[model samples]
Target: MKRNKYLILILLTWSLFPFCWQVYTSFSVSESILNPISQIESRWTLDNYIQVLTANPPFWRYLLNSTIVGTLSTVLTILLAIPASYAIARLKSFSKNTIKILLLTASLFPYVLLFLSLLEIARKLDLGNNLVALSIPYAALSMPLAILLLSSAFQDLPLNLEEAAIIEGLDLWQRIRLILIPLISPTLASTGIIIFLFSWNEYPIALTWISKSELITLPVAIARIAGSSVYSVPYGAYAAATVLGALPLILIVLLFQRQIISGLTQGAIKG
Candidate 1:
C-alpha cells in the first residue's frame, strides 16, 4: 500500500510537472526564466499575461472561438453517433464485430495524413475561415471513436428493456428517445466532453482551415504568440497563453470527472 501510494505520487508529479513549470514561467521575468537558479532582484512580473490579454483580437476571443467550435463539434458528433451506434448495436454479431474492427482501425490512423485532402474539400465547399463550418470536419474526425464508444454503451443494455419498450407501444424513435438516451446519458456526456476537448486543441486542421486572426482557435492563437516575433521568443508570454488556453479544459475535467470515470468504468465493464 505504501509503495502504491509512492508510485501514484510520483506519477502525479511527473504528469503535473510541465503544467507547473508553465505556471511558474508565466509569472517569472525573462531573466529569471533563463537563469532559474540565479539570484535576480526582480524575479516576477505580470507583463506576460498583460501582453497575452491585450493582443489584437485578444486571448479571450480565441477561447470563445474554440468554445463555439468545440460545442458545435461535440453536438454534431453526439447527434450522429447516437443513431449510428444504435443501429450498430442492433446488428448481428459477425457484421457488428467486423464493422467495429474497421472503425477501430480507422480511428488508429494518423488524422494528420488527411489534412491536405480535407483542406481541398474545405476550399471546394467554401468552408475555410468559417468557424461553424469547422465543426463538420471535427465531427467527421471524431465519428469513429464516438460511434464505437456509444455502441459499446448501447450494447451493454439488456435486450429485454428495449423489447419491453416495444411491447409498451413505443416506436423505434420513441424507444431511443425515452429509454436508451437516459440510460446512456453518462457515456454521451463523457464522449461529448472528449470530442469538445479534441476540437479545442486541434491545430493542424484549424490552421489550414482558418486564416483570419479573429476566427482562429486557441491552439493557433497560442502558436501565433510564439511566432509573433522572430528575433526573440516570448517564453513568458507563450507560457501565459498556454495556461490561459488550458484553463477551460482543466475546469471541464474537474467539473465532469465523475461522469468521465463512471462512463469509462461502465463501458469497460460491459464492453
Candidate 2:
C-alpha cells in the first residue's frame, strides 16, 4: 500500500512539474528566469503579469475568444450528438456496430491531415476570422467521439424506462427529451468538458481561420507571445500568459471534478 502511494505521488509530481515550473517562472524577474542559479535581489515581481495584461488588445481578449469558441463548440456537439446517438442506439446490432466502427476510425485519423482540406472549405464558406463560425469545424472534429460516447451511454440506459415512456403516450422526441437525456446526463457532462477543452486549446485550425489580432484564440495568442522575438524571448511574460491561459481549465476541472468523475465512472462501468 505504501509503495503504491509513493509511486502515485511520484507520477503526479512528474506530470505536474511543468505546470509548477510555469507558475514559478511567471512570478520571477526576467533576469532570474534567464539565470536561475544567480543570486538576484529582485527574484520575483508582478511585472510579468502586468506586461501580459497591459499589452495592446489585452490578454483577457484571447481568453474570452477561446471561451466563446469552446462554449459554442460544446453546445453544437451536444445538440447534434444526442439525437444521433439516440437513433444509433435504437438501430439493429449489425448497423449500429458498423456506424460505431466508422466513427471510431474517423476519430483515430490525424486531425492535422484534415487541416488543409478544412481550411479550403472554410475559405469557400467564408468562415475566416469569424469566431462563431469557427465552432463549426470544432464541432465537426469532435462529433465522432461525442457520438461514440453518447451512443454507448444511450445503449446502457434501461429499455424498460423508454418503453414505459412510450406507453405513457410520449412521442420519440418527448421520450428522448424527458427520459433518456436525464439518465445519461453524466456522460454528457464528461463529453462536453472534453470537447470544450479541445476547442479551448486548439491551435492549428484557429491559426488558419483567425488572422485578426483581436480575434485570436488563447493558444494562438500565446504562440505569438512566444515567437514575438526569436533572439530575446520574453520568457517571464510568456510564462505569465501560459499560466493565465491554464487558469480557466484548472478552475473548470476543479469545479466539475465530481461530475467528471461520476460521468466517466458510469460510462466505463456501464458501457
Candidate 1 achieves a global lDDT of 0.92
Write candidate 2's Cα lDDT for 1-271 as tens digits: 9999999999999999999999999999978888899987779999889988987789999999999999999999999999999999999999999999999998888999999999999999899999999999999999999999999989888899988988999999999999888888778888999999999999999999999999999999988873367578888888999999999999988888887788778757865
| TM-score to native of every candidate shown | 0.95, 0.94
RMSD of each: 1.7, 1.7
Error of 1 at 205 (Å): 1.4
- Candidate 1's residue-wise lDDT over 93-210, tens digit each? 9999999999999888899999889999999999989999999999999999999999998998999998999889999999998999989888888888889989998999999899
What's the TM for model 2? 0.94
Give each model's whole-structure lDDT: 0.92, 0.92
Model 1 misplaced regions, further than 4 Å: 226-230, 264-271
- Alpha carbon lDDT of residue 8, candidate 2? 100
Clashing pairs for model 2 are none
